[model samples]
Target chain A: MKKQRFDYGYILTLLISLVVALLIGAGILALTGHNPLVAYRALLGGAFSNARHIGDMLEYAMVLCLCGLACDIGSRVGIFNVGGEGQLLLGAIFAAQIGVWLKALSPWLAIPAAALGAMIVGGFYAWIPGVLKVKLKVNEVITTIMLNTVAVFLCQFLAKGPWKNTNKNIVAGTGNLPGSFWLKKLVPGSNLSTAIIAAAVITFLVWYILQKTSKGYEMRLTGDNPRFAKYAGMKTERIVLITMVISGMMCGLVGMFRVYGAEHIYKSTVSNEYYFEGLMVAMIAQYAPLPTIVISLIFAILKIGAMGMETAAGVPKQLYLIIQTIVIFCMAAETGIRAAIARNRERRAAKQDVKARKEGGNEHA
Target chain B: MHNNIWSTIFDPGTFSQMLRSATPVALAALGGLMTEHAGIMNIGMDGMILMGAFVAAVGSYFCASAAMGILAAMLFGILIGLFFALFTVKLKSDEFIIGCALNTFALGVTAFLSREIFGLSGTSGYAVPSLPNVTIPLIDRIPFVGKVLSGHSIFVYVTWLLVFLMWLFVYRTPMGLWIRASGESPETLRTVGKNPERMKWIASILCGVFCGLAGAHLSLGYLNGSFVEGMSASRGYIAFACVIFAAANPPRAYIAALMFGFFDALGLRLQSYVSSDLTGTIPYLITIIMMVYVVVSRQKRRERLAKQQLQRLEP
Candidate 1:
């Protein structure tokens, strides 16, 4: 039989699972002697409480979404690019260095120059593992993870030794770039700049490239079946290599945004586990770009709101991390839960058929 | 500067230090090799080690006994192993994703729980007493070997013993045969009425136990009974690499781990004299280069094989 087009029931299942997760989170908060209602209200109010807060959330979302997209590319190609933290870190350094060295250039020229530099360097950083996978068959997971360490060292060396902002009499950061190089802030009373527009545009472009292009189609095919694609004469090796390069470029964009738009300097601390969080966001979105953007915003909101939750309810903001972990556990455990449900339904259906025949016989009698 | 660096790198006292540093990686790698041999790719060794170390510290802290701490750590490892087996073996989930999830889960859970339980952010200090070093009488007198072998923590000796034991277990025993068969011939093992799934579970749990011990060694034996957030770092992945380098053989894995330890010790030594930051980057740099080298060599091998096949066809 031809199947019906839409399944409202499936949508309802997703909505219910989300609600259940939130309720469990609220229960945990209550057990900790904090009023979940007050905390949640504070979270909402704090995140969207003002224009400035909203701007911060947007900027944060932009950075995370780019990183998430970068990770999704690698993940789709069956490469776990755990090196987002490293790639982003290095990208920031490259972009900031360009901004620093070319301080005399016009804002428009220098900003794009810095962004391009970041993409190149970031993409190169990721290409190491891609090439290795194609050549040596060494797992990208280990290589990407190792590259993270290398990236951190490279950042530390630049920050402390050569790129140290010597003029500031402190050795922790790079020299600041010209104010002109900074991306113009679009929104008043918020650092949410025209950069958000750039982010949105890039996301759109990425979506187009992934969905509408033959290269993207080839990439998806290789990701799903490299051997089959090779049989189809698709140059699977080149596709694998290019996919990683693009992934790395996305990471570079994330780094460039953080430096040019927000921090305006490269620091070692930026090499933190933000990349892993980006990976988690990508996983939750199931590697779909649009969903990833939405998930990134949700993550940013939760992180931004958690502070207000802490102050209003006297619950530690670390509890937000706990909630995140629980959500991940729920996501990972989803298939198992659905299987159990399906098994139970099958058994119930079998019993119902028997009972239906008995009732029909009694009615005939 | 050259003299100072060379002296530090080649110092006689450095041998003992190297043993101390290498013990953790070697133990974890040895543990990972067991599962890898059984065709179970264990990426959660780091998480297992982290969980083991955290529990060891917690157990020792309240009980005030290092032995009890180690035992508790083992139990934690078993639990994590079971969780891993449930995902990879039973549910047929992606091992890589599950491993990543476990690492993330461990990081969050440990950090949050550490805060709630100890009112500390990353670690609990003085959770258990540190394991004391034991000097073997005959081995103590054997010059350089004695220096490296004797007067080390109990875990150090246990690690070496476990390597030998693992070698024997894999080569000499029936269970070892089953594990090998499971990885190489799953269908045949099933035909023999042995469940490959069960064997994989056993291997994973065993791996977990070793991982737990590795953690205990880090916290109670090495760090003087403290639980630190992200203490496992990327040692888990490094150990997995060691498994690959060793060709999934326990003895070879131990040797590969020692290589890591040698670099780790070299870094520590260099840190004493050079910039700490530069020295700290050494081990990570080596790991990257090593993996890349492995990849390059593998490519060469594939090309050579293809060339040989073409020559054969030409005849």
Candidate 2:
């Protein structure tokens, strides 16, 4: 019932968990015959060594931030949209197609059209599971996972079939979007683009909607207790459906960004589980919007830096994943750890109280 | 042409492949059923199976014995199950979040170890030990039935046995009742002087063991002694689907997995006529449809019962 604020205890727990995870990572590095310090140095250095690397990190962070926001919105409506991967793929392909079709148009008109197309496709894809969850009482998790596989296969089919690039060298992707549709790169030879500004604006809008709007209140209420929300005369089903669409649209926007800003084309490999990474970011942030952004940036650094660590210290990049998961595990167990610590303290206090009382009784006698 | 397509799709070899493909999923589904009945929604079985498959291959590679690989996988499975229980049961953490983290962890750990142990490709180039196909003496001589039923990996028969044994365990045993009660009503289970948490723990561990076996079967028996990165290929989730489709009934879960295998094999066979990519989506599409059908039929049944009750009240 209390507002979910990060009090001192929570911050302390998070810091302790992070330190414990790093220690575990170091132990793993030692076991694997890699120097932990060397690996850590490489990881940090790689993430920030040059302007290009920093730009790449920011580019990755933008996508991850959007994905995290998508997941966060779904969670706020008590809908777990694990199909963000699928939705993003569909969105990306649609955006690519739309981009090429509107190549004759001006950038202002074409870009927005492409973006809207992606959002429609993504939101529509998500709406299927939303409807099933709300109307049929079917589990959304299984359906979304199943749909993800279907979406991936569908994208592969489209990329290889009707949308296939005509160039012999381009093996399995659509033709590149026209130059007019491209988002201007902020750094030369880097993926970071003006799309980052749009992403930031969208993030701010999402934060406002979640924190300052009545619809957001309804969504949170529905997530916290659907039965209570229904009793209070809220349209819980509609809220869930709308939230699912919005979540999906965000995923779609990520796909459009990938096409218009970074890859400039639709490929089956446009995403390397970016949605899952974002989902992890959301989970680590405990489904909060602002924290999701921060975690996404941190995760992006780890992901990009892992490659450097691999090249420098001969440690596997997956070491970061292990560390991330360990941190998540620690966070998941925080409540238990706190409860155990409290119980120990209570027991010690009770023992001291009895001892002091006995001492006083002896003195009185 | 139609007859040829039918013949290709319905051949004895297809059924044999179906059984082979169903083995791992059936095994994992059986494991998933235990946790499902114990009131734990374990979406992490995929990770458990992935870990098991990797560990099994590694164990087989080093030990030169399939049995040892299976043993190693089972031991790892127990540890994973305990880890899962430590969070879900003991710590009262969100099971879904923990499950997701476990999946990610398993993916990372397996990938990391495989690259370290087997080199950059994350595959063992040399042949590791694999489970042998068992030929039943008399059954092997039978014409069509033997072709469909015999000379498969030993896990195929083991899975069939497990399906039957699990049915008996859940429906016929006292502990089985307690496990069900733990899911259905944990407070009632507590009132009967049994710890529901213990039942959940047992179920979780058993699920882990079964999933471990599923992984062993996948790498050692199904894939011919090779460890492929990400080879588990979401079968754990398919197994979860089977468990849901079967409503946690072991025999029914086996049937559900068989259906998946049948569609998978059909899709493979149809690849010559249809695009392989399109064919690949068939099983997943069918899974979604099946889930919808289950919900719809249940809803209809509930509506019919309500209508019947209303008529009786009017009379």
Candidate 3:
């Protein structure tokens, strides 16, 4: 019953937050001497203007979908994994290692090897912090973030030192994977790859795990009330560790797909925007599997469109980042609303008690 | 240019580098300590630092005064603090989420402003009038210690003083007692006719002030008065780790901050011989090790206590 009421509140909060955020975006554009309408139109047009643009946007959305699912796995189990960027990079490096080193293998063998490699490495790397959290009671958030820093540097090291491609003559990015390792592009001349199918499959799998399985129930219980779950004989520690590993594995898929489906080479300089975008997607979707795709698509449109706005309309791409932050702030503010409602109830109850005392006094008189 | 990475460990330059690098983190760590004791964690210190750096750079650049830059940074800190308190304290928002949002938002707005105003991601290397490095009288005559400590921006000295003050503030003062009570038991604070929420807001504001100063030091003092897109480089996160390392103790946190700074300096020094990228991971890796040690030791202590209780019961 409370969840139903909160559903309405969440929608109201989202709508209000979006409106305020848009207004702020417009104000910022104006302050920078750009026409907000033209810029927005350019942005929309750029994201969906051509078949190719739409495909690009879809590709980004697909990648974000997997990342969001990764986030959802941890969040639903009451863990905050801010190491999505690190995990993704670790996956990329693993995929790159297989794709580049094992270049002689057939397409069938090479592709699966790359995918499996990414998943295992990403999951295993994240499992360290999971063990720390479960056995030693170390806070996962700090550990994950620290690991992210390490992972980022590790990727950079590989690119610059051991994996340097003399052919590319660049120090920061690995060489492109063999064509056989690449995901077959869906739309010719677009980043849209077989990754979209992977996104769909993963979505279904996440839904199944979260809804149709006893494990899912246990995980949700752990998230909702860990003490209650423990009292009910659930091993909350094992659940947390498994959930983190699974979440990290899902993030690994994002890196693998990006390597095979999107960027052929891992660019260390690429902004970590997608990591946070995934987090935001999962948050806005309330950790549900399906809604994450929709949220991811919306973000992809803004991000891809912002490039167009930058070129044709003289607006910076940072505008999308600003909007993302606003949405996150609004969503986070929901907790504040929850607290306020409780306070109001307490005040009302106190008032009723006073009224009852007064009625009793009058009756005695 | 020694091939040995270990040799640089004893170099006086390395120590000075650590001192310079740790100054900002130590300040930010102390700030975070305030919020931690008040039962809040300002994970958004990175954002506050970025905003402070940008505003300080802008202030110093336009007004041509380092003093103005510091002042501007502090003012903006107060503003950000109020913004944080309003959302986290008054509205009771999820502090971590709000903090992450604030940091991201700060990154965006500052990047946008910098691009719009200066048409660059970082400053254009103009001569930015910064706080002058000072050479202490007798200290300058000493050897390695003098070289390490004598010459630095005034903010470096201020940080040491602030650390001492914070130690006193969190431990000796009545307000310090209240802050601890707020974190430990807000219900107790309420029973005593005080608002724990209000205390958190105050802590948040103080955090902002310290974070702001940290940023000013980075942009105006350390970076020679230049605002860079990511000059903070997760120092805020490092500061967060330092808070955990010291468990909210100001002096110990200061030491923790220096430890990271030392590793960071070591990474830079090792770059001539080893892969710099690999070396750069040292600070983060050490931080993780420190966290693991702290937890492991605590767990061991708990196990020992449990064993002692079991023995007593048996007897």
Give the candidate number with the greatest DockQ: 3
The TM-scores of all predictions, comma-separated, are 0.89, 0.95, 0.95
Candidate 2 residue lDDT tens string, A1-365? 22246556655766787799989999988898888899999999878999988998999999999999999999998999999999999999999988888878999999999999999999999999999999998889888888888988899898888889888788778888888789999997888999999999999999899888898898899999999999999999999998999889989889999988889999866897789888888888888898888888888898889877889778889988888888899988897777767877887777788797875432110
TM-score (chain B) for candidate 3 is 0.95
Q: Candidate 2 residues B171-261, lDDT tens each?
A: 9999999999999999889878899999999999999999999999999999978888777888888898889889999999999999999
lDDT score, residue A285, model 2?
83
User: Mind giving the per-residue lDDT tens digits that candidate 3 earns over A65-173?
Assistant: 8888888889888888888888888898778778888888898898888889989988988898888888888888888888988998899888877776656567677
The DockQ figures for the candidates are 0.40, 0.70, 0.74
In terms of TM-score, how similar is model 1 to the real structure?
0.89
What are the interface RMSDs of all the models?
2.5, 1.4, 1.5
Best first by DockQ, ranked: 3, 2, 1
Clashes of 2: 0
DockQ of 3: 0.74
Q: Which segments of model 2 are wrong by more than 4 Å?
A: A1-6, A339-365, B308-315
Model 1 docking category: acceptable
> B1-315 in candidate 3: lDDT tens per residue?
443556677788899999998999999998899888988867899899989998998998889999999999999998988889889888977787788788888888888888887775457656566899999999888988899998999988999999999999999998887887888898889789788888887888889989999999999889887888867888888898899889899999999999998999998887777788888899988988888888888789899999999999997
> What digit string (tens of lDDT, one per residue) describes model 1 on residues A46-125?
68888888887788788778888887777666676777777888899989999999998888788999989999998999
